[model samples]
Target: MSNTPSPTPLAPRRTVVAIAAILALGALAAVLILRSGTPGGSGAEAAHGHGHSEAAGHADGEHHGAAASAHAHDEAHADGEHHEGGGAPAARKSEAGHDEDEGLIAMDAQRMETAGIRLAEAGPATVRSVLQLPGEIRFNEDRTAHVVPRVAGVAESVAANLGQNVKKGQLLAVLSSAAVSEQRSELLAAQKRLSLARTTYAREKQLWEEKVSAEQDYLQARQALGEAEIAVSNAQQKLAATGASAGGAGGLNRFELRAPFDGVVVEKHLAVGEAVQDTTQVFTISDLRSVWAEMRVAAPDLPAVRVGEKATVRATAFDSSATGEVAYVGALIGQDTRTAPARITLPNPDGVWRPGLFVNVELTASSRQAALAVATSAIQRMEGQQAVVFVPVQGGFRARPVRVGRSDAKATEVLEGLQPGQPYVAEGSFVLKAELGKASAEHTH
Candidate 1:
């Protein structure tokens, strides 16, 4: 009765097994349908999904790469604009590359004119190597003389004052000396005695010719005349040695100191009414028409400094220069200065070159002709290796290296790195050089 009523008790149902079999059949049917769809069915679906994911990833990568490439191209273009090819700068690029590492001065035509950046042409010229030696103008010793009274005397008057120009035989000073008076007296007395002896000899010779007097008397008279003549000559010689004339009717003590040559009275030791001795030098006269340029030559320049070598002497006090020749070169070296003495005669007709004046002896150490030359002020230091000169460019100037050959105070010889007739900055190159240095420093930082 329970079995029938509870009824088949769900027939002891395998409900879990039936549900599992149905799910399995549904999955199998889905698998078969998927297999019938594409060639690989489920595999193809999985592949399709994987391909979609890969495509999305690839698209993202492409976008990012394109953006990066565009950015790189823009950067390259900007760089190209800055420099010619990111290498050596262009010649005209100096305007912008003024802050570059190159030694270039950038300026436009108007800028150049405003900045006073001048340019000139280089041409062939002679360069003179000048050796500047210190020297001094010395008095012409050869034409200088010290005038002194030969005898002790009292200075009566001074005719010529110091610094007075006098000619030869011009009286510088006058003096009165007792010694000169005595000498003149002796000469006069001797002259009178000589006249008496001459008269006596004439008388005795006339008598002897007539045989009225003895020959002994005539001989004695002749001997007396000869003795008188000798005495007169001796007296006259003494007066001459004392620089006094013998036949002065007035004061015999009067004496004068005369100039021996054309000169200026440089020194006067005696004044009016002053006593002077024989050894006292009353006047010093010097000829200022010519002066000596005394120079100290070093040992290295001894070979070049010779007698009669051409030289130029310049006055340091003023703007004056005179060309002359070397007059002397000493053989002995100075003990203290370690230099040799040299000299050059300079004409000072205008009296401008005075003694003790400082001078510069521009000795021509070397001289040569050059193909191209520039002003010494135009040379500028560049990179500490070579000399640079600013030459004219289209818009401005450029610094070019040049090899120096010879130089002087005014000009310099360019041996290389320069051509004749090439314009360059002649007077104001230093300004350009300063600008170039500033630009270089900025570029470095």
Candidate 2:
């Protein structure tokens, strides 16, 4: 304060005012530089052309402070206009991208045909409600038989083999048995006595008529002949019971087992020299022209599975199926399984079905008319959607999400998201689904 003269209040005020003015000028120049260097400067310049012209006219008359203020206002207005123009095109682009992402799969007519895409109109259809039950293929009991020898004997010869086809009355095996031999011997002895008895009766009748002998003596001869005849008849019946012929060229004990019907020998338990019992099952024969598809029906499904209803039998181990009628349904349920046994009679003329082969039985529980339906094959599963159907749009096909109801092998009922008369891809729709998936992956990348 001693070395320099005291500054005046007016000088300080003037200095502060000059500094403020310089700062305002510097700020305005910086704003102009920034706007000119940016990419949007051209569009900003055109939009603010009128402001620039008016500013030019006032530049000479306005003070530095006012000019800086006006330039700042113009810079802000230009920036606002630039931002608006930039956002408009961006908004339009975003709208287009959204439309493209709405499950649209672009395809040309030629490409669609090449991919085997076929279309069908959705309309009223009958939807069959099918009840599926587990089952197993079994022998047709009505045409199957278990063969046994009536008398216990050692197997002399076994002519039939496992899996051999035979005709009715075909000799299966020959056995030699003491039991049969005894019965046959009795018949032969009785027959010889019967022959003698007939001669005696003829002589006795002649004597009685001619009075060559006493009446009591002739009566005794006649009684003896009658007793002989009775013994022969009883002996013949005994031989018949043992399945032995009264007079045959073979040994007296030779017993032959014959097939009761035309069938295939599915089982054989006897072999040459093997001793067997009367009750032992020796052979199992079955006529495989028909087979049984047997299943266990639960209490709830018993009503739907009735005699004479049509059912479809499908093999579980292989691709085979047949349609048949429900032949039998048990009147009582099993105490352990709490289910009733049901059977379907399938004509197996080709002999494709075999016993013990597991299968599935499909029965039509009911049927109803659906207002709108599509082929079950037409339905496809997509991410975030339960099911979708491909329908034609302007540029290509669009995947329309659908709510499905009852479904069978042929048709599926549509509960929503479809209309009658609307055309949709029925066959080869899987091709379209694959295409859609590929498009989504590409877009994601």
Candidate 3:
């Protein structure tokens, strides 16, 4: 080995420089490969130039070719920003081309051929405006009554049971009262006094006729008899008022509680031999011939619901529906719910409209002419604020934003954005909505 430390292992710096140079060359190659794959490459430029030339020569052919080419270029350059304004030009061009091809004019033609879409002439349709309300069934206030004992005493017997039908004046219970016995005694005394006065008056009348007595004496006896007769009549009325039989006969203290109205007993608060007060309600009777449906209407919808308007009440418990008129609309709105109360009166001859039952109330508002009405399924909610509908086009479906009007569970009135005799997707609208959602998610990602 020669001196000078064997050339110091040839200095490793040279090896390092060679490896870095090779890496730089590989990176440059990769950059060229990526640039050629984009729309800004020479091939794409040449295609654009050819398109311009064709556009100047044959306008129709150029239009179609330009649209197709632009669409392709947009897809190819989606990740690249080498084109004008970093991809805005391609995006705008692609969108414009798509709009021209699948616009409203184009969709109308495809609607005529699509079998899945149904087209109805948008003429005047009779739309019966309806006001939906939350309601509950209640008893008819006019025909219901509570049977209570007039005199305070223990309930000796109870003839009416819960849910039992009773006729007017039917005995519900019997009560014994000391107060009733005292009134009977007064009536007996008044009757005795009246009898004695009548006997004395008869003798006095005989004396006057024979001219054996003065006219003033006979008149006094007759007046006394009249006073006694008035006293007896007063006592008889008092006894009757206490639910007792008059004329000194026993059973005056035994009071009979009778039904005031013919109805079914809905509530019974007292049992046989139960202690009762004067104000204690024994039996609650409700006539089922007529019932009321009480409903709550929102404050905003109150204007449409008017008294005497026709309403239909449906109960889940029964298959039949009742037709009635709006009987009342409350003047005040509920503080918590901000809703107003409305009542519908319906005949319940079969006792179908039971109280405390929940029912659906539909108030029919004034009917109006609707120029165009589509099934509610035809409208798709987009972005919460906008509504979209798919219209069949020549190549594909076109999405349209529409302004909607009154809508019920079944149909929706088209206020703007659609025309007469137009065909729109109705049944498969959910498919279009899913597509929109997918597109939006893809854009976000």
Candidate 4:
């Protein structure tokens, strides 16, 4: 009490309150210590619970950031997929001459039409394997002739002109021949002698019958008549050989050159006042109703170019053509050029197939049925092979790899990789090939 400041009755009450307050604080501290000692209510458990909540929030934030980054990266990649807005594929060079477009090409109808690209459907067709042979037009030798004068003569007049048509036995030219004149003179003399002999023989016969002459005299007169008759017959034959008949006796030396057959005068060597010999060919006439197309085939193709095979003859000068069968084929190859000769007899009803005109002969080697076919001009080279065809797609075309079989000038056969009635590019497919090449080149860079 002496050391402490509280000694009155109010001090005792304050001391009591202080001691009560100290006891209550200590009791609360003890209760807290007990709770900390228990396993279920430990202070570390509380701290660990708070740490778990913070870690969970941090993990969620990191996951959201990673998802955003992944989405952005994928968006930068392939943009060309056949979906909304028609996204395209990634650009990449292909070793097979194809781009990453998967053999697809896009174009509008107007643009395709302007590029001269025509579309058609592939269908069943006949593929004719034709062999093209070099050839020329020639005269039909079977109906041609070379006219030669039978007797030596001087041309008096030319009745037929070059390129003039003439009928059989028509006069082509007239000639005055000395040999003919001599023959005619001999014939006239023989006729005169025959007349005199006939008169003598008649008188002798009358004398013999009436006892006016001896039997020997009558026989001699008869023999003379026979001799004169023989001489006249010989003279007539000699004059008849020169294509001349004794018509009017005024000009007996006249020789007429007549056309051996109906033909056109293709050549004329003799003119007015021109000297011609018996062996000289003075005129040439050819029947142009038909002509021959002589084709020169290689030795290897000789077998295919046989007689009776169908052939097409096309003129090089004009847009003219004709169909005929091969008439003749040479058995032996030419010694100089090593080519076998074949011929086609073409009917020239209009006389249009002139001689010396160049021509081409198409011989059908074989024919076959095609499952799918298109125009030959539509074939394009792709991946170093000429077996590519452009097929129609939505708003575009595709380069389809195909197996090609036989081919001809007009059409090609598709062995595989195509279907009948599928539309494809029939003409101007080269433009698509060019565009594909450009695309490939750009991809390479």
| Reference-based lDDT, each prediction | 0.79, 0.86, 0.74, 0.80
| Candidate 1: regions farther than 4 A off | 1-128, 368-372, 375-377, 380-386, 395-399, 425-445
Write down the worst ten-residue block by lDDT for model 2: 54-63
Winning candidate number (lDDT): 2
Using all chains and alpha carbons, the TM-scores for the candidates as numbered come to: 0.68, 0.79, 0.59, 0.62
Q: Write the per-residue lDDT of candidate 2 for residues 1-445, one digit (tens) a residue.
A: 3788776656455445444444444455455556466664564454355444444444444445555775676677578668976898999999998887667888898998899999999998999999999999999999999998989899999999999999999999998888888888887888888899889888988988998878887888888888889999999898777666787558877889999899999999999999988788999999999999999999999999999999999999999999999999999999999999999999999899999999999999999999999999999999876799999998889989999999999999999999999999999899999998998898789
Q: After superposition, how far is residue 45 of candidate 3 from its true place, in Å?
A: 19
Instruction: Give the Å error, residue 255, model 1.
Output: 1.4
Clash number for candidate 2: 0
RMSD of 3: 15.7
Q: After superposition, how far is residue 149 of candidate 1 from its true place, in Å?
A: 1.0
Q: Whose TM-score is greatest here?
A: 2
> Which structure is stronger by TM-score: 1 or 4?
1
Off by over 4 Å in 2: 1-91, 94-98, 206-230
Better of 1 and 2 by lDDT: 2
- lDDT of each residue in 190-263, candidate 4, tens digit only: 99999999999999999999997899999999999999999999989887787777653448778888999998
The 10-residue segment with the lowest total lDDT in model 3: 103-112
The TM-score of predicted model 4 comes to 0.62
Clashes of each: 3, 0, 0, 4
Better of 2 and 4 by lDDT: 2
CA error at residue 267 for candidate 2, angstroms? 1.7
Off by over 4 Å in 3: 1-122, 247-250, 296-299, 316-320, 331-341, 365-367, 374-404, 408-411, 415-445
lDDT of 3: 0.74
